[model samples]
Target: MTESNTITCEKFLPHHPAAVWKALTDPDLHARWWAAGDIRPVVGHRFTLDMGNFGSQPCEVTEVHDQRILAYRFAETTLNTTITWTLNPEGEGTRLVLTHTDFDLDSPMGRQAYDGMGRGWPHVLDRLEGVLGETPGFDEEP
Candidate 1:
């Protein structure tokens, strides 16, 4: 029952934008929360997110703005999705916006992929909040 071809997810971090940005770009912090290690956030770098019980994606760094924006390409699946992560300062914290473009809800596989993502992202964002010891400036459904 896929309705949209693309979806965007967002979370706000209760920390300095630079700090959250570092956690996002730095391999060490990313490994602590993202997935099975080996990732760097520099433009032109290649990385993989191995979901032990799910699947894997080989992603490549596409763009960066040094604590402001990050973009990447995931080329392991049928849909060539581009992921964009943006950070913006809000008062004393930061807002993170994640847009997974190129999702095709018109296909069976695409629908499955979209459903998987729907279940996966919030858990990681919650982990990110746990890592920061505070909830981000956003609300979630029960």
Candidate 2:
């Protein structure tokens, strides 16, 4: 485990950065691939996505830099994590970067959390990619 770790997931989407950003920020669009519905990107706004018996995580959107970055605080932590999306224009597509950082991953509890995120992010991102192309996918199923 390492402190201040970064897990970056990249994808090439055949769409505009604004469109992708919309999907990342808009509640309706975000719910399609990040939770069990109910998500928004307004700063200081708190929302929850049902995780069944695993408990729902209430998250707050702390900061948003338009199409550049989105940061949020999870659960009861005073510390906040960020997901930076750098949209690089590459020919007829856009290169999307999803970076999650600002968490201590060296401790036992932190390690467990980081491990879970490490496994979860791929599937989440995959669903995101799928939804970008098709209209029949979800991060946690509909």
Candidate 3:
């Protein structure tokens, strides 16, 4: 069996889980933080993210647990990786964990993506924090 690589990033956001969940599921908010896509939390729902210069990549929601977890198959045919977002309430905020797995280290595309995204996820999470801060009521108690 071929070994794969996984990228995990954790960020502490001073927001509620519901708010974080919205940022993950809401198309407009998600686009601002990451890529543009009709991303819903419904399992098996298909969508495509506009990766700009990287082109559009197809994705499908594979699992969702309300405001807790969201997992999906990303770039299904090409990268064939899974992206999972996990939200855990910690005191007055949410600790968001992003797990990107299934990178074929042997392939050039996968290796490149793994290398690039390893550095990119942090910046993306930073954008997510910025978006949450700008959005009204996201930082407040629900």
Candidate 4:
């Protein structure tokens, strides 16, 4: 049974907000965790995330708040969803909150994607944490 169309998750990384922010904005680091793309933290920056078998999805940066918040339009012509990543400084780490919303669950395609991504996001975030862990000097501050 499909519960909800949105995929929301929170990951507590032992890295500072600055590092987490870089991981999200930097394409190389972003690809290490998620899809490969030329993503930047500048609003209006358009990019594409190669989802392998899922094809290339067009994205446009809609909002950015330094290392605090990054929001963008994902899969413009396909999924037409909004993916927002929020970074919050917590004690000595960053609390990363991911909100992937606007899935047209009524359609089979949307349902499939929603279900698949719902399970996939946690693993993606795990990889992200792994990347940060292996970084030469990550989470060394804050």
Candidate 5:
């Protein structure tokens, strides 16, 4: 679902939260699924994601709850938005929810990003699931 200032995408992955969390935090694995960056689970850590043609985006870790939650300020200057990942254990798999909020819909850049990301997040999550399927032991119970 997408709102004016927020885009939320949820997917059920047939993998453990630990595995899903690893894909979210591990730089190598993360790069394979999403953008490349020195992404860590530690709060206050700063990094930049190589967004292909969009250039590099600055991000700062704002919150981390182990495998449960990870929130960060994304595109600090240009977008000035927050991207949050939430993991919920469901059945034998994990329910991953991504919430991207704080878009300045009034601005041209913000509106464009909001529209683009709204359509892009699902594909990104699909890539994440594919990566998990390929990783050894990632699809197995921990």
Candidate 6:
């Protein structure tokens, strides 16, 4: 079977960019959507995302455009991939993009991860939108 080199998922969240930004940065809020990590937007910041049974994956912030984009080197010792999250204001909400790239498909681990993550990311994004929807005072323009 052919393995994937990257896992990309996009979703339109019915909340403002600020709200989605908060969900991406805040650990408590982020845990509700994705893995728990001290994921800040500042470049060079290092953190670990708890990938449940997959263990903690080390990550470093590689790029940041404030609330617009956040990219990082993910699972350096394992999957050795990069995960980027982009947020764009669209209509009355936010357009969120998740790109997981550089999977070493030649390796067994990579093939497993590529298959799993490809199926998993959509659920992750959906949960992100759900979390933001339930959050209070996240999208208000006050």
Q: Which stretches of candidate 3 lie over 4 Å from their true place?
A: 1-4
Better of 4 and 5 by lDDT: 5
Tens-digit lDDT string for candidate 4 (42-133): 99999999999999999999999998999999999989999999999899999999999999998898888999999999999999999999
Q: Give the TM-score of candidate 2.
A: 0.75
Error of 6 at 29 (Å): 0.7
Across 1-142, the per-residue lDDT of candidate 6 in tens digits comes to 8655988899998888888888898889988888999988889999999989889999999999978998999999988899898998999888898999999888899988889989989988888888887888866853
Q: How accurate is candidate 2 locally (lDDT)?
A: 0.68
Per-residue CA lDDT of model 5 for 1-142, tens digit only, reads 6446989999999999999999999999999999999999999999999999999999999999999999999999899999999999999999999999999999999999999999999999999999999999986777
Q: Candidate 6: where are CA atoms >4 Å away?
A: 1-4
What's the C-alpha lDDT at position 56 in model 4?
98
Lowest summed lDDT across 10 adjacent residues in model 2 is found at: 133-142
- Please, what is the TM-score per model? 0.82, 0.75, 0.97, 0.95, 0.97, 0.94
Alpha-carbon shift of residue 70 in model 4 (angstroms) = 0.4
- What 10-residue stretch in candidate 1 is worst by lDDT? 133-142
For residues 1-142, what per-residue lDDT tens digits would candidate 2 score against the true structure? 5345777778887776666776787776777777664556678878775556556777777787776666676543422455566677566567887787765665676666677877788888788877777743322212
- lDDT of model number 4: 0.93
List the candidate 2 regions with Cα displacement exceeding 4 Å: 1-4, 77-80, 136-142
**TM-score of candidate 4 against the unseen true structure:** 0.95
lDDT of 2 at 13: 76
